[model samples]
Target: MATVQFKGIVKKFGDNLVLNGVDVDIKDHEFVVIVGPSGCGKTTLLRMLAGLEEITDGEILIDNLLVNELHPSKREIAMVFQDYALYPHMTVEENMNFALRLRKMDKAEIASRVAEASNVLQLNKFLKRMPKQLSGGQRQRVAIGRAIVRKPKVFLFDEPLSNLDAKLREEMRVEIAKLYQRLNATIIYVTHDQVEAMTLAGRIVIMNHGIVQQVGSPIEVYRKPCNLFVAGFIGSPTMNFMTGKLALEGEALFFKNEDIKLSIPPYLLSDAKKHDGREVVLGVRPDDVLVERDGEKCSDKVQGVLEVCELLGHRENLYLKVGGMRVLATVEAFFNRSPGSAVTLCFNYKNMHVFDKATESRISE
Candidate 1:
């Protein structure tokens, strides 16, 4: 286990800058995930740390030792790639012990390490199986087992489960999380899936356009997103945004748009005042938007025509058209509503978010 540090890390492919002065730190034995959209330079960042990609500027330190110029083999790190780059000619056990054999380790020691990794990955019964004979999940576990045999100081996984089916991906996520606890190893994983990032990481590093966005625990980032990009990226169903201008009316502050007017919550009063008369974006998650039922009264209400209803077993997703703006709401499945049905929605302002429209940055609480 080792601590990893990226101090002002930058990467470039010719004239195109892939990573723009990114900085982040991972404590020893911490499971940190770097996540973002495609072409965000997350994979490039991981490759730089693994010594596969060059850092155009800044430094990377592992275990307090600068490894900027170190070879990939000498960095004491193992990478499991997206494609599970396994040798078709090798058996599971042979694959796990390949690195050890390359290092000219004793046969007995190599066998011992292979057995331990096999047991940890539950690949004991599949030791003689070839990569082609194994399922997608099993193949991925074998890839992880190969990394574990070296006992690297840090493990880097680049979307290791992306090739698996949905159910298999979910199962592998649990397996990998358990592996983290069992080995207590420092791991840096890169993924574009927020579900994976939120569920597996002790701390998450959000990146966009080659820049680090936010770094925090799952709950911290979800509850307190630093900007519009994070607020939109971190949650399922995505957060809804409405563009409006802040206006002061008597002693109250309101966010007014063409079709909706919402009063700013008390906690945001001071911050809202700073952006008075300026355009702001109000953010509300689908879970916080309630569909009003018969005999129910809500202070903040808006009307929309339901466009689509998707029943997702436990919950439903309602797509609505509110004054030319599209809104998606996730609600309990029991509250059935047909498409084209006009409905009123009530927003829970306690969990609402406000961002400066011009800068796309969150307004402080």
Candidate 2:
């Protein structure tokens, strides 16, 4: 296990900047997942750390040793690629021990490592099977086993679960989590899946447009996003955002848009006088949008027309139209409401997020 640090790292391909002035400190035995949409530089950052991509500027350190000039093979890292990258002709056992074989390690020691990795990955039954004979999840386990045999100082996983089907992905997720507990090695994983990042990471690094947007534990990012981008990206069903202007109504502050008007609780936004007439965006997650049902008394309910109700097992998604703007409220299932039905909804102020529209930064305390 080793600590890894990136100090002002940058990557450029000709004139296009792929990564820009990124910095992060990964502690020994920590699992950090870099997550972002495609073309957002998460994978490029991982490649730079693994010594696979050149750093146009800045330094990378492994256990406090500068490794920007080191070769990939000398970086003491193992990478599990998205495609599995198994040699087709080789059996599972052969593929797992290929790296040790390349280094001309003792045949007995190589066998020992292979045996231990296979046991950890539950690949004993498929040891003699070729890559083509194994299932997708099984092949992924083999890829991971190959990495385990290297016993690298740092492990890099680049979307290793992306190729698997949804069910396989979920199962493999549990396996990987178990692997981390057993090895406890420093890991840096890159993925576009927020679900993976949320579930696997000790901390998550979110990137967009070649810049690191925010870094935090899963719950921190989910509960308190730093800006508009993160607020909209980290949650399922996405957050519902309403564009409006803050208004001063005597002692109170209110948010008024063409579609809706609601009081802005002082506990959410302080210094109400300063925010008067400020253009802001109000954000609430689907789960936080409380749609009134069965005469439940909800404070500050605003009326809207139900446009659609999507039943998703135990939860239902209600797409509604409040004047010209749309608001989505996720509620308990069996809503049994038809389209065009009138509904009343309000936000759970405790979880509401207010962002300055001009800067796209969170303004609520």
Cα-based TM-score, every candidate? 0.96, 0.97
Clashing pairs in 2: none
Which model scores highest in TM-score?
2
What is the TM-score of candidate 1?
0.96
- Model 1 per-residue lDDT tens digits across residues 100-173: 99999999999999999888888999999999999999999999999999999999999998899999999999
lDDT of 2 by residue, 272-347 (tens): 9999999999999998888874332333888999999899999999998999999898999988778999988888
Q: In model 1, what are the clashing residue pairs, if there are any?
A: none
Error of 1 at 147 (Å): 0.5
In model 2, what is the error at residue 182, expressed in angstroms?
Answer: 1.4
Which candidate number has the best lDDT? Answer: 2
